[model samples]
Every structure is written in structure tokens, then in C-alpha cells.
Target: MKRFQVFAIIILTGAMLLVASCFWPKDNIVVGERIIRFIPKEEILDFKVKDNTQNVDSVIAMLESRAYGINEKAIRRNSILDESVFSESDYFVNPKSDGGGTALDNFFRYLQKSDSSLIRIGHFGDSQIEGDRITSLLRIMFQDKFGGSGVGYVPLDDVTSPVSYTRSSSPNWVRYTVFHNRSAKGLYCPGGTVFRYRFATPESTRDSIGSNGDTIKIKVPACSYSNATVFLKLFRGYSVAKLWYGKATEPAELKVYNSKTNELLAEVVLDSDDPFNVMKLPLKSNPVTLKFVFTGPSPEIYGLSFDPVVGVQFDNYGLRGHSGDGLLTISSDLLKAELIKLNDKLVILQFGGNVTPYVKNEASLNNIKNSYDRLYQHFRKAMPDASVLVIGVNDVARSVGGTYASYPMVSRIRDAQKEVALKNGCAFFDLYQLMGGENSVLAWNKKGWASRDGHYSDKGREIVVNELYLAIMGEYNKFLIHGTTAGK
Candidate 1:
């Protein structure tokens, strides 16, 4: 065909496609885990995605220069990074009504004189903060200043390898969670997980020898008679340590040993049939590594805590793909009991982002907001004295002809979050606005802070954590200056 004939054919095809776009369905199609959108004629020409990243390498490069220098004798820098990102989000949404708008007041007051008290902060969210991505840094930011040692809570089978320490369990242990099945039973741990172990007996190789000088081989039963061990290495000194487990249906023996020295730390016989129990280890010195050996019928190990009775600790209980409403799965009484026992002081909830795809319109958004409100109400009942901090969803990008922009419903979600938070007497942090409003995800992706315009990268988490630290410190400083009436 001639060049003019080819050009005419291409133009005709393009025109046909453009005209046919008008008939496409307006509603987004949901496929498995993705929302497929069909573009209409009106939005066919808009290429609005912008590069919004800022180069702050020089200003924040020195943030994560070193690791947390943990020492029980002396106070060191709280965290590796102490610099602020100077984000557009300047303050939290704590409204005043009749001079009673103190949202984070309880938490701030605790931080003011935290030297003698136990302050536990629970950082709960979806995969964004998984594997201790965001909570580890925040724990560092507060622990040294508040006088704490040890990592907070380590579940029996922490699907994500944590950042602060190493935890290895026996292969025979089975893990269960409420994320996939919201109506899951049993007393779930704060991490939304629970572990079960079939009782095992030690290999009787030494005892299998016969008196007639005959040698016999013994095969340890995989399910009922194999030695299973749980190993923990903190790499640093921790003044306190404890283990949490469920009812000991049968008599079991737990032997705690110092892996480095082979020294026997403690041996306990667990036969109590209580629904829950705490085994506090007797640590003579700040040991770095320990091993747990289980023999006989084992109880359900809920989680472990390597923390002090007095100081600050943040537990990372991130549930991937959770919409903040999954907390209802765990028995409310059990949940409240766990929080009260932990002495939980603050609960920082980072949600909305995970559920945005499910919310397409006003009713869905409102449903999410109501869900969050219910979540906070449950939390209040669980930890009456604890303060809750609601972080609005960060910017999420949607493409329009290759132009990426914030989801249209993001602002509405943020507004709903703020409104509900203030109404429920919880502190609200406008994280969506904090990242420069609309194109923030794109900007973060441009700076390599977030991967795929959503999940945060290392640099992305750092800047975000830095901003949060600055915000918390800002409020704490005000509390220091103005006392409890700072809001006035």
C-alpha cells in the first residue's frame, strides 16, 4: 500500500476507537484483586500525572547513619535520625470544644514523665508497616529517651522477619491468623496471629541401649516426639524478657538457655490450665542470645516480649491487607485483657490505604469510616486509658492516559477519617495532606521513596517516620512548656 493509503487507514482506526470509548461502562470492573477502569471520551486527552518528588538527599542523608546504640547504663540518642522532613502537614487534627479537645493528651502526658512508668505503644496497620518497617524506627525514636531496653512483642510465627532482632522457631509449629478469615476463633495475639505446637518427646537414643549389649535405633516421632526449639537473638543488651502462652492443657517442660554460653537460664514446668500465662525469664546480665527448648505436651505460645517494666516499647502488629476492621475477629474480652496486661498506652493506627480499592463511592467510603469508628470504640473499651492516633491514608495514584494523580476519593476518605477521629476523641494525623496533598505518591515514587506509587521504600519510610517523630516531638515539647492545658 502507498504511504498516503497507510496513513488514512491508521487515522480511521484511531477515530473509530475514540468514538467507541463513549459506550464503555462507567462503573469500574472488579477483577480478583484489581479494579479495572474503562476510560470515557471526556477523559481521553488528559495526561495529568506529574513528577512531584523533591531531592532532599543533602538534608536527610545523615538521618540513618548508624544503628540504635542500646545500653542499660547510659542514655544514648533515641534514634538514628533526628532531623525533620519539614512536610506540608504541620499539625494533627485535634479540635477543641469547650476547652476539652485533648486527643493525644493522655499519651503526651505519659511521655512527659515517662522515666518511672511503662509506656507501651502499639503500631497497627497493614503491610505498609509490616516487618517492622515503620515501627522499628519509631521505637528507636522513643526508647532511649524514655529509658527502655529490649524489642517489644515477637509472635510465635512472625511471618515477616523483624528488623530489630532474630527469632527462629521450630518447623513443627503451625501459624494461624485472622486476616484471611475474619471470624477466626481462639484468643488471637496482638499481632492477629496464634501458634500451635504438637507435644514432642526427646529422642531416646541414649536410653534405647539394651542391657544385653544390643544396640537399638529409635526414631523420634515427627508429630509427637521430636525436640523442638525456639531461638532468639537480640544482638544487644535487654534488661527484661518474658514469654506469653495459652493454657497448658498437659504438663510440659520449658528450658531456657543462653545460646552463647550454654548456661542454663531457667527451667520451668508448665502444667497450669489457665487460659493465659506469662513466663518471666530471670536474666542475670544483659545477654544477647537465648534458646527455648520444649518437651512434652506444649501449650499454645501466643507471643514473647523482650522489654522492661518501665520505659517505652512499640509493638509492630501489622496485618497485611487488613482494613482495620479485622480486629473484631479476636474475642473482645481476650483482646481487651491482652491490652490491659501489656499496659498499652498509645495505639497508632495506619489504615484507609489498604481499603481504598474496595471503596468506590460515597456509601462505601462512609462504610469504611463507620468501620474505623467502631474499631476505635472497641479499642477504647479495651484500653480505656490508652490514646489512639489515626493516621489518614497517604496519597494513592491512579493513572489517566499515563498521567498519574491522587485517587479522587482520597480527600473524602481523609476528611471522613478526621471527622470520625475527632468525634471519637482520637487524635488524627493528616498523612494524606502531609505528603503534599494530591500528587504526593508520584513525588515519593520519583524520589524512590515508594515502590509502584504505593508501597513505601526505605527512603519513603524514613521521611515519613521522620515527619511523624517531629510531629510527636512538637506536641511533646508543647506539653513540656504548657503542661496539660496546652490546648487552651
Candidate 2:
């Protein structure tokens, strides 16, 4: 009886093992591939191969030839040939194609050329540029290397609930956004006067104030107007106006005196916008502080000019959840306008950070490159004369057999990005290799350059930006001094 029981137990255990084998799932994480979906139709249409580079030997050559010829034909027919499997990231989304070398050199020449008296370099990125981390550092470096001053654009006010700038106050005004989905009741205002009629004071008498550390400025003609005039008034300060009539022989002087104490503050003559005027004011304090006391019928305030130069660099155009879709999504008109505002525009498209987290198959991966094509077209249209660069994904690793291994497919995604840039005449910088080959981010995390698992630490970010800057500067110098070594 004991023997019979033993046999039955063995039989039951074997049956259970068989069932488990049939039903249980296997681990699916691939080691090196990027998380990109290769949409077959889109891939063919976007990554066509060109004929000129048909016989080149390197990986870059083969990839370019295949992409230009195949992608071009596919685009023409409104079709794609992406049979490649999806990988781990979107680094290849909107990869460049064709005219890389010439595109790069021309962009460098543009940067070196000084068009504006005070050149402006606008570096727009997600949170990376926020608080002027990379932008500030880059600005200082560039200004030292090149020449420019004054922080180009500044938020008249900052409204982050957490507060990210140098100084912090309880609450100045409320904040509102046209692009972001949020609204405030207090003295909130959208980015610029962009979304008309949205500016207001929290309460009727509420006031919000901020300061630029050691920087002090006072407007000579506090009360001023321009183009269209509307009734205006000023409080808590002095004002002045100046005028030039048929080129006056001697500079005319007008003075403002305190009615009670009879304190002399400034001397000038009030002038009109229809006629240009220059006014000067003498401030009692070393750091000048004067408020506008205006009673005018003008729509514009003309006399509020400050020194054309200031400190710090800022570029905050990073989109957190975006997948190389930012350029494609921003309106053509708005993008063009912003590009025009930048003195030496440097566009760096960094992606694939999000794509690594989730991806399932090959076809999806190839289709991911289609997004790169969209990005290329959008950028070309938005900033026809701007310098564009691409930063591919860093090395990401996955756990395999009790250890982390670099997935083989990562190379494919890198190739895709390079091909796209080369084809589209844009410059591509390999962040993956720069960060130290496959699984480098893991090392960066170990060095505390990266956060606990993902994301970069302050130090890590600095390192990344420095490398980028060096690479960028190297290219710029090569082009500027060498003179058109590469053909378009």
C-alpha cells in the first residue's frame, strides 16, 4: 500500500510540472535593443536609401545607403518597409538623413557670424534648461568664448509651486499657462502677453515683486508711451522725458523736484514717440530704484529701457513625456518666431530616455524611426537657418540570467539615428558612446551621476552637458577655422 501511494504521488507531481511548463511565461526583456516600435509601413516611407553612397564600406555607409534609397522610395509611394523588430528605446525617432557635413559647417558659420549687436543664444530643452543649469553654464562659456550680454528672455515672474530659482518669496502673483493645463486665481499671468487678456492682480490692490541680486536699474524717463497711447499713471517714483527737435544745438534739460522737501532727482524734457527722445536721471542710491509715475495717453511704454546686457543663460524647453514629438507638435508660426528670437540658435533633440522603459517587438522598433522623419521635417520648416543637433540615448542595461547585459539591438537604434541625421543634413552626436558604451548609465548611477535607478544627479547632468559642450565647440572650431572641408 505504501509503494502504491508513492507511485501516485510521483505521477501527480509530474503532471503538475508539465502544466506549469505549459502555462508559465518566460522572461521577455531583451538585453541591448532600444525600446522602439518599427511600424513597417512608416519605416519604408521614412528611411529610403540614396544611390551615391551605394558602395561605401562602413556601417554608417551601409545604413545611409539603405535608408535613403529605401526610405525615399517608400515616402514617394506613401508606404514603408519596416520589417525590423521593435527594440527598447526611441533614440532613433526622427533620425537624420543625407546632408550632414555641409549642414553642420554652415550652421557653425552662422553661429560665428555676429548679426545682432548683442547676440542671443537660445537653448530650449525640457527641465534640463530650467533654472539655467546647462543653459547658464553654456551661456557663460559661450559669452566668454564669443561675446554677448543680458539675459535675453526672462519670465516677468516665476510661478512654480515648489520654487526653483535663487530667491524665494511667499507668493507674488498667481500663475497661468496657455500651453500647460493649469490656472491660478491670484495675480497669475501666462508666459507672455501671448494669451491676451489673461493678466491680472491677485486682488485689486495685490502686488508681487522680485529682484535680480546685485543688479540695480532705474529708467530715466519713468513715464513713457509708444505706438498707441492710453491714459497711464505711475506711483512711488520719479519720471523724466527728453526730446530732439531738428537736432537741437544744445541738449535740452528738464528737471523733477520734490514738491515738499524740494529734492532734485532728474533733469530732462518730456518727448513723444512720433519723435525720438533721450532723457537722463540722477539717482541718490548707488543701485538705482525708481518707479514710473505716469499719466499718459499711450498704449506702449517706450522709456523703460535697461542695460542691454545681463548675466546668466537660460533655455527651458524640455518636454517630460514627449517622445521626440516636441518639434513636430509646436506650431510652425510659433516655432519660427522663437527661432528668430534666438541669437545663435542651438537645437539639441535628446530622446530615448522614455523609450527604454517599455517596448515589445521588432516591427514596432523600425516604425519608431518614422517619428525621426517627422522631427526632421518639422525642424527644417521651423528653423531653416538654425543649427540642429541630435543626442542619441545613453547605454541602458537589462538584467539577464542574474546579471545585467547590454542588449544587441541598441546598436540598431543608434544606427537609425545616425542614418536619419546624415540623410537630413543635420549633425548627430553619439551620447551612447560618450557615456561609455553599453550599460554606461548603470555605471553613472553607481558614481551617483544618475539618481537611485534612473535620471541624472546634478553632477551627472554637469558631466553630460560639459561633454556635449566640448563636442559642440570642437565641431564649431573645426568649421569656423577650417573653412568648408565637407561638401553638402
Candidate 3:
């Protein structure tokens, strides 16, 4: 109860600050007209949080541990892949294909072919995916099974980039996103955020409030957003590092150095050839402390991808406090410009938890379906080649009298989500059902896998994503067995 009071006090304090602030965007969290956006930590706060080695090695062990069902020793390869005969977690319902193959045939085929090409899976979601919780495990599993390395596609200024690596940017670097700043003029990367040096124009900003410890920064003007340096501390190194960006108005100096030793690794003069540009650096040494110094002109810095020449890479784009509706504002041209060049295969859309608290009537329910359908059409136009999978809203619990229970409207939203996925020829995964339906979160909380707030704890996420992995592999197994699900 004291923790609740402290949080409430913080909220009240933020609200007071929001009232005084001249300008702020209403993107992510909207609580009774005040923005309750959970801001990402700036690189300056890097020392505050511990990192290095929590993801890769640890996650690999969990994957092989036989957590949910099949044991690695008994299954070897065939038993784990035998979803039809062995696995019980079957919530994935895919979009109908053109009759010859299933919707994910192209994705599965790529996995089967053993190509060295990087298979990109963009996982888009709400706060549930922040801090690279669920997606990190997926990256390690895919990379281990198929072959790949490095965390893929992190925003230039990320609040939840990935705990696997430690990153700090110059405080002058301010972030603009589809949900964050409405007045800022810039296109968003797949992560829903684009960054600029402090020089960029803006009305006002809400920098990470109180997250820097006890002090809430209510007003930060356009000229000076932060004061920090750019450096990446990798727990594990990658052979290839690719930096993605939009056009630069002038040539910029992007020099790479070993942050600890200050030894120059590579130096490059950057100017975009087209609307989108990527600078691939072949690292000879995996420096423990790598620093990036960008000077001169600020490009529309999208994010960086650390991957090998071959295997699968999954990018986590978590847009907090949003229903899936925010995609309507994301420009298709911008998305295509950044993504069209990649060997993109699958796009996972996980959402609807943020919308549960707002459901009051039937109109709100229809809004969910309509917005999703529109977003689907827009996303398809943006990246037409990729297979789309919609993971329905997970179970949401609310306080009733004293104890917590499932919200009455969760099933309605899940139904709408399933409908949208089916209607649009997108694959559907019934996360609500997989979570054991209504009030399952209560049980999850009992097991320390869930909180009353609806987000999954670390242990719970491992199990949640484990099922998702099996479901995808199950389809692949069928593909391997049947050859094709397309019409004859």
C-alpha cells in the first residue's frame, strides 16, 4: 500500500508539472487529458542500471531447459519441431493464403532454405514489449537455431533499447516519435521514433520524468534537451554493425572509437545517397567500450542493427500506452523507405492491453476493429511482402472490491482483434486464450509471472514467448511435412 501511495504521489507530482508546462505531445499515455508517457532512460543514466550478459547466454539455457513442455534431451530436433504430435500450445491461427500455401509460407521457406541472408522480424507492440523483454529471447532462439548475432534495430534514443547492451547518447540528442511529439517534423523509423541533436526545433518536451532519480524535468526547451555522450558497452560483440538513417542535409562526422581506450576503430563521412541510408561497419575487434561521435549535421537517425552476415534478426518496437490505433499516423512512405531495403519476412503486431481500461461501450469496441483493419491495410501497403501476425490482447485484470479479476471487456477486444486478423488475411495468435482466458492473470500473479498492472515479469515472459515460438515452429513443421498449404 505504501508503494501504491508513492506511485500515486509521483503521478500527482507529474500532473502538477504537466499543468505548468507550455507544450507536450499527447501520443503514448493519455490519462484524463494529462500525458502519462513512460519515458525511456537517457544514456546518462546508464550507470544507474546494471547490464552486460543477462540476455544471450542466460536465455539460451532457458530455451533448452524444457520449460513449458518438450525436453531438449528427449526431443533432440524432431520432437521439438513436432507441434502436431507433441506440443500442446496451439493458439496461432494464420491468415488464409491464395490456396497453394499458408500465409507464412515465405517466412518458413526462408528458414528451411538455410540461406545466410538476415531474416528480419519486426515485433511491434505496446509497453508489454518494452526493455526488450519478450523479443530478446526470440532473437537468441532464432539466432541459435538458424544462426545470427547482435541485437537488431534499436532507436537512436531509446528508453528500452535492450538491456543486453549499455548505450548512452549526448544529452543534446532529443527523441521525436509518432506518439511523443506531434509538433516535431520528422519521419519515424519502424521503432516509431526518430532522433535529432538538441538543435532540432520543437515547442517543448517532457524528458524522462523522475526516472533520473527524484527530480521530474517538466520543461526542457528545444535547444538543449540533454547533456550526455554516445557510447555502447556490448556484453557480447557482433561482427557487423549497420547504422540506418534518413537523408542528411550536410555531411556528418561519425567516428567510432574504443570508449575505454579511446582507440579509433573506424571513421566515416556520412551523407545519405537516398531518402534512407545505411552505413555498415565491419568490426575487426569487439571492443568492450565503443563510442560514436557524431558532429556537423544531424541526420534523421533511425537506429542501429548489430547482426551477422547470416541468420534471423528480430527488432523490437515497443510504443508504450497506445492502442494499435497510432499506426494510422505513421507514414507509409517513411516505413517503406527504411524497411524496403531489408530482407524482411515477418511482422508481429502485439497490442490491445492499453485499450482495455478505456472500453465503456459498444462504439469503443467497434473502434478497435475499424482502427486495426485500417492499420493492417496501411501496414500492408508499407511492407507488402512481409507475413503479418496479430497477437490478440493478453488477459487484463482489474481490482473488484478487494481482489483482482479479469476486465469484463477483454474478451470483446480479443474477439475484435481475431476478427480483424481473419478479415484482413493476417495470421492470428489468441494470446488471451493461451494465457488461460478470463482471470488467468490472477493465476499468473500467483506464480509471480504477472502483476496487477498487466505486464509480465521476467519468468512469465519466458513462458509466454516459449508458447509463441512453439506455435510458429508448429506451422513450420506442417510446412515441412506437407510441402505447401497453398491451393493445388
Report the number of the highest-TM-score candidate.
3
In terms of lDDT, model 2 sits at 0.43
Candidate 3 structure quality by residue, lDDT tens digits, 141-244: 77766777877876666666666777877767778767767425546677677777744545565745364355354676665432224788766557688877
Shift of residue 389 alpha carbon in model 2, Å = 1.1
Give the residue spans of candidate 3 off by over 4 A. 1-88, 199-228, 485-488
What overall lDDT goes with each candidate model? 0.71, 0.43, 0.71
lDDT of 2 at 138: 60
Which rank order by TM-score, best down to worst? 3, 1, 2
lDDT of 1 at 404: 68
Sequence-dependent TM-score of model 1: 0.76
Q: TM-score for model 3?
A: 0.79
At residue 217, candidate 3 shows an lDDT of 45
Q: What lDDT score goes with residue 424 in model 3?
A: 68
lDDT of 3: 0.71
Model 2, 335-388: lDDT tens digits are: 565456433355666666556545445775667677776776666666676556
